[model samples]
Target: MAHNEKLALLIVLPSLLAGCTSAQMNMLTGKRNKTYNDVNAPWVGSTEEQLISKWGPPKKSYTLESGAKIISYEDMWGPISAYHVCVEKFMIEKGIVTKWGISNCPTRIKGSLPKDTPIPQPTL
Candidate 1:
């Protein structure tokens, strides 16, 4: 093979490998896109300072009995496909997410739930 061809292959091979590794890293890290609005991105690594820099102040703030700081924020899920959305709660302890829970807001439908719609009873 020509010397030029060998050098070209060497460069292209490393570039291709690097691209594949980066793609895999992005997928594993859940960085589907670069945006402050991606709800799927992991929130545990955030510090109070970094969170404020990115998303500003929380809508509400509270402290748990264990002395953990809980900052509440409003996150919209979908205006696109499914058109269903809800606000989620993130539990941050010592600047790390310990747990998360979702609110049971009504799902958007063609029309609002009927006035006569019975509330489902909770089951054990």
Candidate 2:
């Protein structure tokens, strides 16, 4: 390859590699970095009321055509933040928690709960 081409590759290669490394790290430690305050272990059967009582209020929620409900919560870390900032989702069906997951980070979703939605006081 030409000298200029080699030089360009040298500069770009590190950035490309860094991006890949960051993605891999997120996949590996994503769940461990989540912050769950309300519901306890073995979350499969926990009810929506139980979750609200523990984690205050969710940032957003939705109801699907199949009647399943999804509630999301965010962990805000003040001003400075990192990839560790995350949003967690709880799947509820028939008044019972069925599944849950954590995303790499949080993002605003259109039509989400209004900013004024009341966050329930923590019961603990």
Q: Taking the tens digit of each residue's C-alpha lDDT, what string does model 2 give over 5-80?
A: 9999999987876766433544544422222422322466888888888887889999999999988887754366
The CA lDDT at 120 in model 1 is 34
Q: TM-score of model 2 relative to the true fold?
A: 0.48
Off by over 4 Å in 2: 1-41, 78-84, 105-124
- Candidate 1 RMSD to the correct structure: 14.9
lDDT (Cα atoms) of all candidates against the true structure: 0.54, 0.62
Predicted candidate 1 versus true structure: per-residue lDDT over 8-122, tens digit per residue: 9998987776766433655655533232222413555666676667777878788879987766666556657655445445567787665544454333222222334343321
Q: Could you tell me which 10 consecutive residues in candidate 1 have the lowest summed lDDT? A: 105-114
Error of 2 at 20 (Å): 28
Report clash pairs, candidate 2.
Answer: none
Taking all chains together, each candidate's TM-score versus the true structure is: 0.39, 0.48
For all candidates, what are the clash counts? Answer: 0, 0
Locate the minimum summed-lDDT window of 10 residues in model 2. Answer: 31-40
lDDT (0-100) at residue 93 of candidate 2?
92
